[model samples]
Target: MKRARLAWAIAGTLLFAALAVAAEEGKPKEKRKGPRLNPIAETMLRIDRIKAAVEGLDLNQEQQDKLAAIRDGFEAKRQAIQDKIGDLLTDEQRRIGQEKLEELKQGGALGREAYQKLEEALKLTDEQKQKMEPLGKELQELVGATLKQVMQVLTPEQREKVQQKLGMGKKGGKKGEKKKEQ
Candidate 1:
């Protein structure tokens, strides 16, 4: 819980920095540009870690195929969300746009469906779930560490620029934007 919380904090801070950067631009550019990784990217990285571990397991072809399908299914769903975010929201709205992005990250209706499918496919035994719990927690910490490292490497102005691009500051909010309920 501590690790997940820390990771989320770092990710949120990084996103805030991106939003600040975007605000610096005299006008909202069609897209805010900056060096940052969103939570979605971090989640995908954790999924990849899971995939790698699962791949090393001595499972039968059926298990392998099913797991691959599970991974692909979630990846595709994530990609779809990313595509929608880019097209649907304005550049300013996209920055500081943590609420909706987090909603998508937490998984919406589509996410629940995908998770159900993954549970079916992985056939995770109680033991497996227990083992995976710690791994998942560790992955969250690693993501947080990475975000911190990235933030440390960048300048304050650069950080703010990234935040602006993300619509995180006063200059970045849109009129119609609403906090997406998880």
Candidate 2:
């Protein structure tokens, strides 16, 4: 009887492990993070990429000075926004924040039109666009992968607690969703 019970326990453990591997395989990819770039910042980055890609299009001293000035001004404005958010946002600000973020990404105030203007002003080219797109994509993927790896080092129970705190652990999902395999 003891031997039979041991066999059942081993089988249960194996099944649990198999379920974990299956769930990991089924998991969707996560979004990446970096220096949180606004639409304007992203547009500026694309412009810089184009300038770097085109040979002999390097900025002269005056143009370089102007670019530096523009970047400094943008940085100052960003800092001010961060400072203002503390006084402006209330306890019920998360929904509004999400809406505003979506609006910005959409056509709220800074979207395709702004991108177009920057592209034209910077004389962006197809080759530069191709190069920059891949770089940005790769950077995002790298960040995601790094996050996954760090999370993997945590025990299943530890991961569950962290995810729950972060409000990401799903409810009523698969039984093994938060359970650690043997």
Candidate 3:
């Protein structure tokens, strides 16, 4: 009777161990969340926002075509700059940049001097800085042009709404102040 009980206990223990292993193996792995958008994904999301804002504004086909063209052109320029920057970054720099980007995504503010901090942190070479400067300027130009084109596509009322939505209007005044007022 003692041997039978021992055998049964051993069998039960083995079964329980197998069940625990199976349960662990069958469990779903948690998905990792990263940056809200990669560079290219960000450009596409921006374009989508423009589209959503302009919807129901009764734009003619030609104006819509122009907007599409402008978006596509800007996206290409943005992608090229992103690729260039990615190429220039070392693996370690990329890791740091990604962490910074994630922080920005999480509603963290980067101060005006953030670029200098980034430069120091990345230890960017003069040659890399030179290459980055023009690309940065080009990106700024593309953004301005894209905004102009989007505004042109919108009516006066829609433009105001867009400005407000983009936090360029009075309602967007001094981030914390707006929240406080509300």
RMSD of each: 20.4, 25.9, 21.1
**Per-residue lDDT for 61-138 in model 2, tens only?**
654565455545544543343333223334443244334334433554332333332223333234433333433343
The CA lDDT at 127 in model 1 is 44
Tell how far residue 157 is off in model 2, in angstroms: 3.7
Per-residue lDDT for 127-178 in model 3, tens only? 6555555554455456667778778776687777766645454442333433
Which regions of candidate 2 deviate over 4 angstroms? 1-126, 164-182
Q: What's the residue-level lDDT of 104 in candidate 1? A: 43
Model 2 lDDT on a 0 to 1 scale: 0.36
Query: In model 1, how large is the Cα lDDT of residue 60?
Result: 55
- 10 residues in a row with least lDDT, candidate 1: 16-25
- Candidate with the greatest TM-score versus the true structure: 3
TM-score of each: 0.30, 0.24, 0.45
